[model samples]
Target: MSNSSTYTTRFPLLAKADTPAALRTVPGEHLGELAAEIRAFLVEKVCATGGHLGPNLGVVELTLALHRVFDSPRDTIIFDIGHQAYVHKLLTGRFRDFDGLRQQGGLSGYPSRTESVHDLVENSHASTALSYADGLAKARRLSSEADRDRAVVAVIGDGALTGGLAWEALNNLGAAPERPVIVVINDNGRSYAPTTGALAVHLSDLRRQADGARPESNVFIELGFAYLGPVDGHDVSAIEEALHRAQDLGRPVVVHTVTTKGKGYEPAERDEADCLHAVGAVNPATARSSIPAGQSWTSVFGSELATLAAERDDLVAITASMLRPTGLHPMQEKLPDRVFDVGIAEQHAVASAAGLAMGGFHPVVAIYATFLNRALDQVLMDVALHRLPVTFVLDRAGITGPDGPSHHGVWDPSMLSAVPGLRIAAPRDTVQLAEQLREAVAMNDGPTVLRLPKATAGPPIPSLARMDGLDILHRTRSGPLDVLLIPAGPLASAALEAAVLLEDQGLGVTVADPRWILPVNAALPAHAARHRLVVTIEDALRTGGMGTALAQACQDLAVPTPVITLGLPTAFVQQGPRAALLAEAGLDGPGIVAAVLAAHPDRRPPSAWSATTLATTPRGRDDHH
Candidate 1:
């Protein structure tokens, strides 16, 4: 916790305007001072906690103005990509809690409903806020006349409008012009990197027009929206006035306010790469990350994919507004024409990749696993049904930390496994990532996916032997196989550690990595038959996931061995360290050992287990395996 006296002294105006009600009481003239204070506070605290610093820094005044103009809690406000709602959180009496932003049991990086009444949507995904607003407004109209008077504002920007859902919501909202829904386009002209595609060009034109003559008509006007702005988002007075006019209109309105992402911070403004969009714990003075650099799973895949692309003229890569973050920048830098940035349109990217594949090009659609959920239909029908040679390299495939539930990549394997011809690969380390990627692209018949976690790629874990497609990571030197442990992707390390602990208890154990996780490798069931018990560990949902599929495969093959699967439950996991979450979920070394002992047919009692082992057992069973 920060010193209260020091905090109050630094930002006197901010101290007074802790809540929206209190903010409304603040003198209008001192609002600029308050905004400045908020920016400084954000730079200090967010940089310290390592979160969406640039997005939050960009929206200080806009957030302040919205709270002051609209009666929040009564008049609901929804931030599109809720990372920009840090300012909203601050104004809603969360200023003191800023110290714990994105930490476990602390304030989330995005809007969390449990955190405050001011936050209507906990969405961190790009777009979808307008749809939420539209629903809320319709509900208000149906509920009561008093509710109808309440305004619904959807604050969307940073390339969120590029998403198809945002357009769908705009279409619905525009049709009902009488609905008092304020669509604030907080255009900073970026989503991680600069916003791409035709929409970005259109917004650029609008910005240019704003500097000169007022345009008579625009896209918003054509959609039946009362278009306002190209207003300066930093000017709280102008934004409040525009918002007030929008309120009086009693109709759907579009207020296009332009703001600088990473505003007031020189380092953020100067940063060409994501504008310091998201950062680790940083030196506040220089706005540089304090954490030491390391090669990540994303980097390994990116480097290898670029190398492969250079070798194969037919290979191309695509990203939906995250070229740099997804590690497509290497390929983009080397072969400019082959890499595509499709804005915040994952659906379009996947469909386009299918088209690319159909044209004799094997397209690699590199994207975050969570974002892939948006285009599952495309991956299934458009790609898999057609059997296109498109490799989806999913970065951040598992339990991603800090960004919270919405950002976790736990659903991809379960969902993608349902696609008939799609093959999924979970690389155990950097060596396997490169090797598996080659295998993924070489397959000419159907679609393939390579999923990896967000953590740094540790030293390579070499396979003892390759059986069929599975990598034998560990095996007892001389004993009957008591338990077979199958780990998905990076969990191979943890599985090996558990094997050693099990071996310490005089139990023979075998650990295997199913590099190709989906379709349950043909030889897996036969191997399961060799052991008395089989355990599968993954950083995905327990239901309908890798474990479930493997168990079903074993049952089909008449392998009588009992299969006990360990994975995250079907629930929204909160923001925290990935390591901590995995340990809590019983996916760690000690946790895995405990689960194995509990399930093993020849298991010894807990009292008989080593004291060192029992001391490390995870506390609760309700949330763990």
Candidate 2:
């Protein structure tokens, strides 16, 4: 069914059901019914629109129980990694618009403060809720307003708990005995892949026991917060009772609610390992088969890295709880001892990898571009400061559709650009990604970073002429060079296409996708010197992207070419198809051509508008990396 049709069909759920069956039912009697309904609703609605699937499925009952007891907006509920808040959205008067999920100007994939009053926080990033909870709780205490006697509840998952920031928040919350913040640990035993470490195994043991299980309280208890439950999360009444108990306790408390990933779905339950954590657009009946067969860029990297591991026994692989997504599962499967799944702890992933590198082993720290924001300090201090040659394979390092602002990998290049001596590589194709990975692994002087998009393949463009600094993909024939196109990440195809379009319009264009687009290549200076207009396009933000860097390089080199940058704008872009976002940002083929013409008005032909030759332009294979 179409999203619009589904929205119409499910609109009535907007008005909170009068004495809903879940609300009326006693703690134990048919508690799982509401959960079942929620799961079915989510599958039906989300599959059509393609929002966060595995997360919402796992926390169905827990979300229902929280809303049932707590008066939201008054009593704040902050969700860590808010992608799992679909059930929360449905109950809080957002049911009608739920099917319009993650579309442009529609309901966001993550919680949004603007959407409704029920949403206290709009955090999509992980390991941030606990800290927010601490601030809110403390602020309420200091105000001493009678109306401010509200509860601050942070629904943090086991995955988010792995982050050092979560621990820092926990420590502060625990230290403040006066503050009343309830920490709900939604333990599903997975974060992308099955969670790792002694803590995960310990939590698993606690959840498995039915009776008299001494809740091993280390992080919360050691810090002096009361800990409760290893409760069956599917039991709505049980969850309500636990939440009430924690609220009544009047101090910081940890309510560890144990649930199953892909709870109500039989397929999800049996398979395990974060069942269908995310789903792409596909026919609902064949959703499972939608992910194409054969290797993704991640799989290729993993397979090749694993082979590299065999040659060098000291080679170790690490991931920040993204074993499956980052394609490190194969490496883990082959070399269990060498591969480390560090849970949702990005800082630990980078720092630990640095330590491994320091200890005479080659460590590859693989992570999603967005998630790596949490580990900037560690990367700069522990890795780059020590000059450790840690290779970070950044997955999803560009515009990620549907997941929205928090999920977009647009800021990695900007942030990483600040780290001195960090060699950053943006591969244009799968072959380049593999080759770059090998190159990064071999580099021993300093930290090496390779950024690639979610896609695996693109049109098979022939290997470009390799110069010392840049790979010259295309060079215009004998004519005044009007434009120099710099391709960053997967946008190389678009740049090349734009070049072809401009070429037909009698504007000579030179296109280059820098193999290592970091620290400002020497060839960029020469290329910019030759062209009348210079344009740099990347999937990252324009503020500190390759465009800015190239512009800076030009300034340092005393070049006077007018630089036109094309990329994601400063503001947060909403979730939608990647093509839509690119077009909106004026980074698509026509957009690029338009921007180029705007910069070089004199270069445009007299009948530029009358004869649109873009359609007839011979298309090349898009080699996406």
Candidate 3:
């Protein structure tokens, strides 16, 4: 039989052209077929490309119901953390481009504004949709066309209410009875890891309560929202009915529709550890993917930390709903009592980590670099001010490639610079990671941070000399230094390559990985003074990062060397491969050389610089040394 016929026999209604209208027209008999088809489609496409498969599979019917109930562009639907928006994208005229999910110049893993106006919020961060929806609703109310019956729907899943942002919006929205917004809680009892908090407990109680019957104390109802049902989210008609009720309310309402996390696919359903929240490129049928040959930076950190935890009785691990993702789960398994998964509340994570440290325990708060920004105030006031012995392992330090702007961890350097007494270490490779982990834990006076990029653990480059806390990886002849390249973790390889290139072009080079990137090494300025021009390279924004600090240090030490900082521009980097993004941002070897050349035209390689330019070029001769 033909493929069409075979698919028809299996999923009769779904084998045809699947559109919003087509989904709406699907016969009641074949609703199951359509759901199955969507699941099949997700498995076939998402598995091969590698994406948030389990989340999409869980929300097939819910997505269909949402599209059927709401006129998308007219009635705004904002998905919190956008990972569950795959089924929404599939139904909203983007099924064809689904093949290129998370790829460069392709459909984004998360919702994109360029793709459609239907995607109101592009933020991949959790528990943000409500705030966006609240703002949008306020704008709509202020506009002349405020009287229209347009629905504002915020689909939040996996205990997003555990966060303060959602609660703040909820308080405002619920207090104002006239403002219309349908808050759909896609309850699946997770947020990367199994969500743990008082809010998560409350949600559990809500889930346990009978359908359409308010619990003894309903938070939603008490908060001025018309609570609908603990409905079956997997059932399309049931969810549609709840949504219809919400739309008819003409006020703030919450339709608690509980669905399975990783619903249909066996591979995801069976796997209990996060239900394969995100996956690599894998076989569609078997859900199999090849693991990286060597240990990843995450795995290496995890292994080392676990060993450290085993030795130290006071050592504890903490995560904000990301156990496996940040590599803290291993330590958690080894020392269950000491590990804390603080739901989606990073603010709480920081504050509690401070508390733990105050209690004479060494708290290692392992979290994503981007997420650490959320709890900066807590880090500054609660942790740093108190001089707590809290070690922050910031995983995914820079250019978290394909997950787009909101997910990239590049802002940590700039943001963390403001924190007093906080020592930040950006490890270049696996060896440094282990060494720094020990250093971070050993510090009892103040907070220490270990920031690592999201990539495989590269082989160690032996240091020629240890200058202060920095590892001088490469050094040229003893005479004069034309350049001092100090690339942080992500751009270390590129900086070394650029040093080789500069050396070949008759330029003296010294490359280093400042093990402790923060606290600006006191000895760095004196070393930099020996250079004609100091080029500080990093993948973070050059504005307020390590490069800027070093440049300021040069001036502070009375060094005349002009510092050229090479880093990502102060803008949101687009989604792409890490290597490609680095090149585009001028963080690669060729790009670094170009940046150095651009800073000093006379220092450009002889082959690159023209005769006329060289004749007119004023600088490059080292005077300080």
What lDDT, from 0 to 1, does candidate 3 have? 0.81
Q: TM-score for all predictions?
A: 0.97, 0.91, 0.93
| Tens digits of lDDT, candidate 1, 1-625 | 4567677888888888989899999888988889999999998998888988888888998999999999999999999988888899888988888889999999998888898888878798888999999999899889888999999999999499999999999999999976779999999998898888788888899988886887788888988899988999999999999999999999999999999999999899888888488988999899876677899888877898889999999999999988988999899999999999988999999999999999999999999999999999999999999989999989888899988999999899889889998898988889988999999999999999999899987999998899897889999999889999999889999999999988998899999998888988889999999999888888887767778888888888778998888888777888899999888788888888887787677885475544423543333122112
lDDT of 2 at 544: 83
Q: Evaluated with lDDT, which candidate comes out highest? A: 1
C-alpha RMSD by candidate, in order:
2.3, 4.6, 4.1
Q: What are the lDDT figures for the candidates, one per model?
A: 0.88, 0.79, 0.81
Give lDDT tens digits, candidate 2, residues 1-625. 9755555455333233312332433344444655666677788777887767778888888987887778776788899989888888877767667657888779998889899887878898788999999898878987868745798899988887888788889889898889989999999877777767777877877776758757555556888889888888878779889999998899989999998887776655665655368776545554465656555678877788888888888889998888878888778888899988888888888989988998999899989999888889999999999999899998988887878888888888899999989989998888887788889989999999998787757755554687766788888877888888887867888888899998988889888888788888887888888888888888888778678888888888888887777777766778888887776676778767866765574855345632322321112111111
- Quick one: best TM-score, which candidate? 1
Off by over 4 Å in 1: 608-625
The TM-score that candidate 2 achieves is: 0.91
Better of 1 and 3 by TM-score: 1
Clashing pairs in 1: none
